[model samples]
Target: AGWQGTAAQVVTHTLNRMQDEFATNPADCLAYIGTCITQPHYEVDERVASRLPETHLKPGGKPGKWMADLKGANLAQLLSAGIPEAHIEVSPYCTWADNDHYFSHRRNEGTTGRMLAVIGIQNKPS
Candidate 1:
């Protein structure tokens, strides 16, 4: 139940199926990024939480604690699909953490001034 029922569940299942169909290595990943890890230094939103195995919160962490367990599970799923860990890359700036750089809907007071940042391998120029 680590992630079979969580949002990451789709990622794992999808990646596995993609590898099986395309006969590609996980290193040839077909996915994107994860979530923002709960940092002690950051005053994250504790309202976001998950079930034990489905959560990245440490043991004994309260329900109000922030969690990115699904994100971690997604990474593992990609690796299991044959993608190398080295290929995975993520940044807080893409999440709600970095408001100034990355527009956050909530932090921006539901303003439409948020920036859309996409992460993926750039295709070679034709």
Candidate 2:
């Protein structure tokens, strides 16, 4: 399903909820991949659009439609929640725009898709 609220709201709520149960902070570092700010994927209510950051919203091609910057919104929320700017890295790629490199359910009309995520810790030099 699509985002229930602005990306900022969704990200903030999720981080807060995770913090409640996790022993460590979730805002230490963030790496965003796919679905970049370049894609105008949201058509939201004006009230919700008003809450989004300036860089995170733009006029959609059609009236009453607004393109939202998903990654920008999440980055804003993470920074507002005390995460350092240096610790956050946002990818320049957009899954919706790059069909050959990424899978997008919306672009494919729910026919098929795949998810990939990777995380690792580097070993300290002796």
lDDT of each: 0.50, 0.62
Which digits, one per residue and each the tens of the lDDT, describe model 2 over residues 29-121?
A: 464533432445545556666766768778877776677676667777777766678877777776677767777666677775666666443
Q: Candidate 2 at 15: error in angstroms?
A: 3.3
Q: What lDDT would candidate 2 get against the real structure?
A: 0.62
Per-candidate TM-scores read 0.54, 0.65
Best candidate per lDDT, number?
2
Off by over 4 Å in 1: 1-8, 30-48, 51-55, 59-64, 69-71, 92-94, 113-126
Q: Which ten residues in a row have the lowest lDDT in candidate 2?
A: 31-40
Give the TM-score comparing model 2 with the true structure, all chains together.
Answer: 0.65
Q: Assess candidate 1 and give its TM-score to the true structure.
A: 0.54
Flag regions of model 2 displaced more than 4 Å.
5-8, 18-27, 30-37, 40-55, 117-126
Please tell me which predicted candidate would have the highest TM-score against the true structure.
2
